[model samples]
Target: MLAKFRQIKTSYFKLLLLACLGFFLVSLTLLFIPLYISFQNSIVKSVSSHSLKTLSQTSYSVEFMQESANTVAEQLFFNSTINQLLYALDYNDIDTIISLNTLNSYVKSTLFIESVYIYSSKTGNVSFSSKTNGSGFEHIDDFYDSDYLKTLKANESSRFIPFPRITSNDKLVYSFLLPSSRSSDLMFSNSIMINISAKWLENTYKSIGNQQDDMILIIDSNGVVVNQNAYAPVLADLKEDPMIVRILNERVNEGYFLSSMDGEKQLVTYTSSPETGWSFVLLTPYSTILGSFANLKTIIFAIYFSIMICGIPICLIVTKRLYVPYSVIQNKLVDLEVRYKSNHMVEKQNKLHALLVFPSPFSESQVLQLKAANQFKVRFDQPYSMLLLQIDRFADFCDQYPIRDRALITYCIQNISEEIIGKVVGAESVQIDRNGVCMLFNQTSELQTRLTPLVKEIQQTVRKDLKLSVSVCVAESGHTIADASQIYQTARESILNKFFKGPGCIVYASDETAKKRAGHSEYQPARQKQLTDLIMVGKFEAAKKLLSEMIENLKDAHYDYFSQIILTITLELNNTIQLLEKANELTLPFQFNTFIAKINNMGSVEELLNLFFRLFDEMDAQLELKKKSKNEKLVQEIIGIIQRDYRDVNLSLESIADLVHLSSSHLRRLFKKETGSSIADYISRTRMEQATHLLLSTSLSIANISEQVGYVNSTYFFTLFKKAHGITPAEFRSKYATT
Candidate 1:
């Protein structure tokens, strides 16, 4: 065993291992010593502070309990039986024995009293006792002859004396004294005794003691232990403990004292009872009080050992792999942060002034803000008009291109808009999805002053680059941006104006104002009445001439309503022209450009008459062609309806003629001329078409379809359907309706 021990101790390999182990152990100890000391000190301080807090709490609790007991005693002393005894002392024949028995029963049932006594200093009368014989207190005059009685007599008031021995129960009692008015001089002495059970005091002490492993005691002013834990021997000799003696001598209400008790150093914290003149003391052992810090030191040592054993090797391995990437990322991050910080102050200035360049959606809050900021009044609130311009053949352009190229085209259009408006007006705005731009100006004067050059610029730029024509519609001034959406709708209507009046033009709301003021002109009210009568009779040309004369008068007079009257006439002319074109497919060479320019320049009735005559001639030609085509289409539609319905057995040339409101022969001839076939042949073709549709679309057999199409014979229906469609019914069904 000795040789083996030496081998284990002296082996070179093992010595190297032991050396490493010792080095680690020394390093770990040195590292952890300061931590352990700090942890230990912290725990000690925490425990000490907690103990002091608990001491204060316990002291307060003791005082509260004592006050509660005093309240109970005061309530008991004022009982009806006790009050009767006080009143009955003045009457000699009041049967004091009955009252004393009543008081005894009252004390037993109502208060937690062992016994109660009423003592008279003048008559040396002690009327109550718990003893069965009632002989113990009969001669007890000197017993009540104490300093407390003297003090009570001197003060002529109530006094509470705690922890007095009551011989009736052989236990500590709390006594209350009130000067009885029935005394010989009404001043000497009055006293009351309430012998409380010692078990109650013991139970209160036990309650405070059970909160912690501490010794708790209740002691009187005379250095006797009234209530204390049975295991605490230090409290048995109160005279030997200077802290207790000092407490009694000093009569401090509350404090802490450090002293030796039963040869062991301890802490004593005490509080005096306001009700009973006794003090509650808490005694704690020093070593036990400080033992709570051990776990903290152990935890700190464990943490230090873990760091020493595993931390360094792991850190070194991780650092070796991470150093390069981490350094690169760190340097990049540092550069980015520095750049961001430096550019932060300059970024606001670099933001593009897009507010003026983009059209704002008219939201109520934005309008309110504009109003509040006075931007609306200052910028757009005056007699400012709106112009909404849209591209005419944009859809055709998009449909002709690939999606990517379409997007590029749209981008180019936006670029063109920016360029044109940016150069001409100096104030440019755009709404892209709507494919339009809005131009606001003070009035028609501003628009005409600024717009001619701008429109020329736009026409030149779009014609050169995009080869697209542009149409514009201008709304009269005095509307806000909130009404910009309505203006955009009006502009859409104006695109049709180009077709009615001719292309490449600008139209204004004022162009429609003339019709609104037709008969209101001063000259020839009779002519105006004649014009109304002619329009009612559908003599549109005569009415047109009269309206032209009225517009001429307003223009020559330059009346306040001239713009209004002219706009109305222009609107009426545009509508009449559109109607004529739709009915006749007529073409007009008159351009809206001339009308807009003439309206912009005309200052007399003769110039207005010239424009009106030009408009009327174009419209009359359109109306003549519209009437002819309309009559032809009506005749052809009647013939098609007759052919479709002739297969019904109830069908007749008369009914078919009636459906188109014509005589049977006339319908017959019309059908023949239009279709190059007789009515009977057309009916057969119609039947074949219905048969073919049913055969391909339904599961019904050929015979049923034949009957449904007014062909009685299935064979004939099949023969006719095949001749008309070049396929038999079964073949047609197989080709188109295979399930």
Candidate 2:
């Protein structure tokens, strides 16, 4: 009857186990559905976040430009000087020139506006443009009055006009027509108009794209491409995509969706700008994003399916094999329990190690009871000392040795220390942490003196016998066994001082105090200079060593004081470097914001030193490169400025200084250093060159050419022309003229 009942019970247990395994597998598989859903949601969220950020950046850029336009228009409406200028432009009287001066000032004050025009229905058109010569209106109007303007004037429904045309040099020019202000009768009355280059918009849009596959489209509300441009060319019409049509019809402000067009899967994002009522569209191939997900899902499903196939048979076989041996295993467990109870000495040693390493706050009576309970217990009658041995270059050691070998090495170190110290005095060895071992021993005198020789023995054994280099530090003697935490803390601090002392040297807490004569040394100016010199010379390791020494030697160094010192050095370094950058018009590759974030997270002096080392190393390399290129870049900038604004009568050293954010004397020195010519001489040369080109190439008159090349005085222009070309302006033009 008993045998039959056992068989039945075993069969029932196997069935029960099978039932639980099936339930768990079913529940796990059910969870995958929600997991997949969550993953899908996460993908959408990530894509939307990126899309929204792109939308925000693009919108901000457009709004920023539009807002700048609105500022000028706002001034045109509100400023009496500007308003009077536009209204009196038709008279061509004294106020007409005053209005032109005012308009020129506006163009100079603004960044992007190249010219300004005022139109009156009663008197036709009057314009002030930097590109024009003289107080000219009709000559400037010759080319600008294209059929597009005529068509735009016929409707006047929109103030923002899009016109992209190729210049004579084959460069595509972006042109926009902006009406400056709104009035009650805008079409019939007076109006101010402005012309600006739209190249900045195209460049800004192209800057956001990354690869050859990406495309940027500026689409209107009617789904037509208003502006055609980007770094990469779009091969397909995005408006015809079903997802884009759905997004437009849904009137979603901003989002991303996957679509297919021309047999290519595409990821499309669209956002409508509040200022223009036009949508900004970004499109890339869907394969770029979702290709990895497909493989990931397949691998994940394969793993789970394998587990389902393998789990049932393993459970069944294990259940069938275990039941027959139940009685014999139960008897062996009882015998093992008896043997475990009999071995009190080993258990006591384990208890002692546990109490030392883990938290065990005990009263004197409780401590006494614990001492009585353990074979390797501490005797409180004598003073105690804690010696901590830390593995030097522990990470290297870990990487070189396998786990089992590392465990054996640790055991060997512990056994050697215990065997040596246990013979001489009452000492217990414990593995306190990875790459660290603690020796808690009772001594009759100062532990530092007594344990100094023992540290040498342990070091020799670890190096000579075990082949591991260790740095050991011994703490001051404690009065009782209960002082383990404090003693261990001091010993750990002694090991921390090893950051200053190079590895393989044993250190002691007594030596640390003796080194600090005062609680902390005052922060020094010479040390700061030394730190800067080290960084400037690119001696990063030496700088790190010096910083660590300074921190470890500070008299009662709190984290706040050390942090302030570190931060002061960091910020001062930044300020000094930034001043250099500004003077040279050079930008370093170091991201200051990222540096600041890492600096803020540094919790210790060592971490701060490490961070500054990296920061300074990168900065030093970039600064070296900048130094080599600084003068050349400055000279090139001056040349570019001269090329762009050679027509400005007011172009001078001081004006160029303000434009390039450098001192006039500094710009002069650098320009001469780089190009062997002064800025003034270079500007003169540039003007003469352009003047000669105009003389040879175009039909512009001599006085017009003089003004166009930055000479307000025709007589002075003729004199310079003689000096530069050995001929007068008319003579030069007559000599070079074809007709």
Off by over 4 Å in 1: 1-81, 87-94, 129-139, 142-158, 161-163, 166-169, 179-187, 208-213, 220-224, 229-242, 245-259, 265-278, 287-293, 304-739
Distance from true position, residue 166, model 2, in Å? 37
Model 2 lDDT, residue 546, Cα: 78
TM-score of every prediction relative to native: 0.31, 0.42
lDDT scores in order: 0.56, 0.67
Candidate 1, residues 1-739, lDDT tens digits: the string is 9999768655743444555556666877876786676665565455444545554555555455445445644554445445444333353444455566666664556334555566655455555645333412342445432433443444455444444443433444444443333424544544565555555555654554343657767676656776536534422547656787877776557766567877887766666655556666767776665577667667776787777778556544544444235677889999999998667423321211133233444455655565475343223444455555556555555557776875565556556755665543334334434345555444545546776567657656776787766666666555555454555555555444443233456666556443333434455547655654563344767866677656545543323455655665555556544544434333343546567666755433555566766666655554555455445665666666756664575655676777778888877776676667876776776777777778877889888888888877788877888887788888888987875
| Candidate 2 segments exceeding 4 Å error | 1-346, 354-374, 377-384, 393-409, 419-427, 441-454, 460-468, 478-486, 513-518, 523-611, 620-641, 644-651, 654-663, 673-676, 691-739
Model 2 lDDT per residue over 642-675, tens place: 9999999999999999999999998888888778
TM-score of 1: 0.31
Per-candidate clashes, comma-separated: 15, 3
lDDT score of residue 16 within candidate 2 = 62
